[model samples]
Target chain A: MNDPIKDFVEQHREDFDHLEAPQFNLAGFKASLAQEPMVKKHRILNIKPASWMAAAAVLLVCTIGLWFFNSTQQTKKTEQHLALNKQNKHPKIAEKPLVKAVTQNAKQTQFAAHETTSHVKKHQSKEEVPFIPSPDQMLYTKLNDSASSSTRLAAVLAIKKSELISYDMLDRLAATIQHDGNSNVRLAALSVLEKYRQDAHVTNLLVNALNHQNDPMLQLSLVNLLGKMQNVKIDERLYALVNDPSTLEAVKDEVYQILLKENKF
Target chain B: MKLQLILLFALFTTGLSASAQKQYKLAKNNGKLNLNISGVTVEGYDGNEIIFSLPKNEDEEVDERAKGLKAFNSSGFKDNSGLGFDVTVRGDDINVNPVSVANQPKLSIKLPRNVRVSFANNSNMYQDTVTLKNLKTEIDVAVTGNDIVLTNNVGPMNIKTLHGSVDASFPADLKGPISIISVNGHVDIALPASVKANLEVISNYGKIYAADDLKIAINPASNPKTNATGQPVKTLTIGKGVQALTIKSLAANSENQDENAPVFGYEGGNYAESLNGKINGGGVDFILKSNHNNIYIREKK
Candidate 1:
């Protein structure tokens, strides 16, 4: 080798080396391009003379290896992305809507709102009315609103007009009490319901507030409702609470009066 | 609105002023006091008659001012005209002048062709017994403050009194829905053996003695019904028969009447004796109701 070639090889030696170890096709590459294109006897060739061919051949092999490696890496990434999508995405996403029968079946077995929640676009129900005083507002109106007074007054007047009660209105009143109204309005509602204990959910609501609600006055109204209902279901449920001692005298007299009316006196 | 109220006040005031006239009456025929009032009705074969039962030794008196039958002394006929009527120059003091109206007194009158008695002048507080028999057409009789006795053939009878016992002899055949009432008196009725007609009787006080054949029924109360004071009411209808006999008695039961009998609808029916009202116990298809009274049902054979 010439001195210039030797110097060039020594200086740029690492660039020509592979990280794992210099890899190359010495026989196939060097031998082919070693002799002239016409010389048959001279099989081996000098690398210095075939530097361009050697470099070109190496570059071509690297290009092919890089293409295969990158193609394989892309395939593996695709498989991983698919696996993650399968594992992480919710199962419902693949579902086509229940053709027609499922839609038809949704109409029945309506469950109450705020009850038995499971993720389903269940029936959209009329808002749960509170069991309150008004026939329309089953739930009590929130006293927090400025209009609650007027609404509550309207409810009272409507209640006074007749004895028949609408349970839905009571529910609304209950809801209003739970969410909107002041304790006082709710207490008033309870007083109005004093005569009716057979009402469905309202009594339960009143019973629930027996201890927890802040309003102390509501207890009396609740007791009044419980007693007047005359149902053993209610009266017996609540142990006898003596409210008006003076009434005991009247009750004794009442027994006499009742006996007299019965002609037993 | 104020003006309207003022007008209503004036209208009521005028009505009150108009009702201020206290009623007064005079006799018109020959009776115990010679009063020819239509209250004395005849049933069969007898004409119109005016009668008055006088107290023993209380000479039958005559009020000369009575519209008719004056001349107690002037007539050759002794003051004792020997007529069915009696008269005394000096008679008992009568608060009212009893007289029968010249014309019909807007009353139901049944007069037979044989007997005829018109309005005459007389004085009397009560006529114990009065009969106009053989009445076929019509008759009108009125009496006040007196115990009246009426007997006649099947004709309409309207008897009224202030306070006295009423013994009305009605021909069993006398039909036309009999109605007997007393403001304060006992009503004794004799129904004919065979008769079917509605009867309505009322007495402010006193017992109801009726013929023994009337039936009783109880009325059912209507739903959402109200008593007198807007309270829910339970009503009763008691009695039955061809006649819708409605008997309303505003009578405070004497000791014997309610002694042991459980009385319904009468607790509130007893009227104050001062009220001097009536208890009704006879009628057909009639409604008998009294604020205070005792009602008895009787049947006629």
Candidate 2:
């Protein structure tokens, strides 16, 4: 248990215990769309700007190139953080203890961490199950890369980890979701929000998008969240939707049922 | 000569005077009561005191009873005179009619203020309404072959009969838990909004419904512990801050809440063993079993 890998796993377990994930919106985004006006558009591929298929094809092609692009970039931030804290040497600030422990002794520590995790998953699964970065992270890393920019590479790696605690990672993820993401990636973001849906600070933002969004697919994702809640009192936004004549009949009915089941109606 | 005959008749009358019927009374605390009965009709009375009378029978197995012999005249009758209630044998079954208050049985003992009661009738038919009231300090009951009516506002109570239907009424502010089970019969129970308890109900071949403004919370996956220990050992504790209530029909995964939320320390026993179909709810720990019956579970807040 004294081992750093085990210690980190324990800490991870505690962090996610009794956690309620904050929900996020599921829709297309536009980064800096409201920021700058002047821009020079590049004409590389012959396709309409609104043709999502063409953009997806381009992303599929870019995937191969970005894989190698992001890995080399990840160590740079760790190196930067390491250099800044070199004198203090805050071991706790390491981005991924499992990863760091593995790198220190890759094969041995990974085996030990896995052994402890298989047994400790009762509570620890709350954190580990959700944060186990998806293949999308790897794909995101592969597609979005410039061999020279280490910051962009760091973002790519952080996407793979899905444990991005810094604004740097959030901004990059937000930027990627906004500008160049494929439809599948956009949908994946919505699905991933279940792990973070209960975070109070971000839940309202997610709820606002769900309430206002016209996309059928995004609405479906929002509807699914009704099943997960138990302890928290029903949100008032949903209360209005149940009776609001302006809302769609089906959505209104769904909201009403949730309210009725909770006896808030 | 006439004077001599009169004097002999007077002497015989005084010498052979029959004994008056005897009555013996007994009182019991909260526990089981096994009564032996013969030609006894437990008449349902509305008042607090249970009254008894020896029936006048024209024909019966005991010739003494057939000749209108009072129960107190019998040798075994306990004379509980002027007490709360009395148990007496009656020759005619007409006194145990349904129109009157012939529902709840009059038992000897008094229960706690808030307690759960269950009735299991093996033979004969009886019917009456059992009420659980606001001042539910004691539960008095009777049973026969058929139906049992729970007209009293009892505590977290259970009423199960092997062959009769259970029809009971609960108080608007029912502060205690309740469970009524009956075999080969239908059960009908209603609760008000103010009643809060985890309702694990079962109506083996019958329908169940709670359509009023009642609030029953159901959380099956809320705390599903899948192996792995070292945490607070997630237990499906119910009945905390709730008036105790539990009912089951088969050996299903269940939890019985205690009636009183008293302090408890782990005695050195197999904790996991006790966790078998165990859930903590209400304020009491109930040991429930379901054997061949349709089961239902719900929570009303």
Worst 10 residues of 2 chain A by lDDT: A81-90
Interface Cα RMSD per model, in Å?
32.2, 26.7
Score residue B5 of candidate 1 by CA lDDT: 100
Clash count for candidate 1 is 128
Model 1 lDDT tens row, A13-122: 99987567557878878777976574753445443667888899999999999999986875554332210111112344223123222332332224332244443336
The segments of candidate 2 whose C-alpha lies over 4 angstroms from its true place after superposition are: A1-265, B1-50, B53-120, B124-135, B138-145, B172-177, B223-301
Candidate 2 local Cα displacement, residue A189, angstroms: 45
- Model 1, stretches more than 4 Å misplaced? A1-265, B1-43, B46-128, B203-212, B217-301
After best superposition, candidate 1 residue A220: deviation in angstroms? 50
